[model samples]
Target: MHERMIIAGFGGQGVIMAGKLLCIAAMNENKYVSHIPSYGAEMRGGTANCSVVISDKEIGSPTVPKPTIAVVMNTPSLTKFEPMVKPGGLLIYNSSLIDQKPKRTDITVVDVKANDISEAEGSTRAANMAAIGKVLALKPEIASLESVIKALDVAISARNRKHNDINIKVLKAAFAQK
Candidate 1:
């Protein structure tokens, strides 16, 4: 089955990096994938969004009008993309940044306290990693948990070890909560 995912948040939150990592992992799995990132004024606080499409067939267009999954790190991003996700899709919310809940009943919503999970793991910036973990766990196209950790270990640089580890923990914890 085809899956479309969107990760949106403020700049420096690794929103784009997370999307790229998914693309990397999907490609590693030998699946057809495409990652499109939004830039410019939206990169700040306005709205930074990145889309990842994974499927068995050739992806005709990267732009998605209806995503199968969405990871929103802020309220505005959540509100912006909430309606775009299709019925029976998935939406992972960074509860640390958003206070409101999704009102729709069609999609499965997973609220992750990603920031706290990252903080407890010893880094504040790793929240994005944590969110990524949750997304990977819930998405079938993503690698297994062990594979994901292994990928991250090899993918993360020496300087980013701390961030990488914490995010993996966040992903594990989020999965457990589900």
Candidate 2:
């Protein structure tokens, strides 16, 4: 299986972290993976995004010109990446921040109230994790929820380990959605 994903949002939205978590989880599952992150000079609040590729075979390039899955956490990101998703691909957008709906009819679109769910779970910063969880739930072939939880242990640093429990909770909460 091959999955090309683009995760995007404002810099502080954990877009890079979500990509890292997906790579780490895919790696733990013994899959070939690649990740490339991009962000503006201003960092937090500025635009941020990452391309992640997971496959059973070797990857030709790290860049994702047209992604099979696009997870957008904000309106700007939605505007930028929505048209870039391949036909028949999946688009997951955070409804809490984006009021506009996707225009494409060929691809599947799913909306998650990531910020609201994360806030309800205790931390709004974990909205990225929530979004990832939804992705995993919708496309379990890419990576399992267990692998992603384990990835948190590896992706999150020792100093920030305190947030692991909350992040895990958010992940599970989102994954449980129907």
Per TM-score, the best of the predicted structures is 2
Per residue, candidate 2 scores C-alpha lDDT tens digits across 1-178 of: 9999999998789999899999999998999999998745523544689999999999999999899999999998898899999999999999999999999999999999999999999996999999999999999988999999988988988998899999999999999998
Q: What is the lDDT of residue 125 in candidate 1?
A: 83
Q: What would the TM-scores of all predictions be?
A: 0.88, 0.95
Question: Which clashing pairs does model 1 show?
Answer: none
Q: Which stretches of candidate 2 lie above 4 Å from their native place?
A: 39-46
For candidate 2, give the lDDT: 0.93
For residues 1-178, could you state the per-residue lDDT of candidate 1 as single tens digits? Answer: 5888889987778888777777777677778889999877655666788988988888988987798999999888998899999999999999998999889898999988888888877777877777877876777556556656666765666788766656777667766666
Instruction: Give the lowest summed-lDDT range of ten residues in model 2.
Output: 38-47
**Which structure among the candidates has the greatest lDDT?**
2
Residue 43, candidate 1: alpha-carbon lDDT: 58
Candidate 1 global lDDT: 0.80
Q: What is the C-alpha RMSD of each candidate to the true structure, in Å?
A: 2.1, 1.9
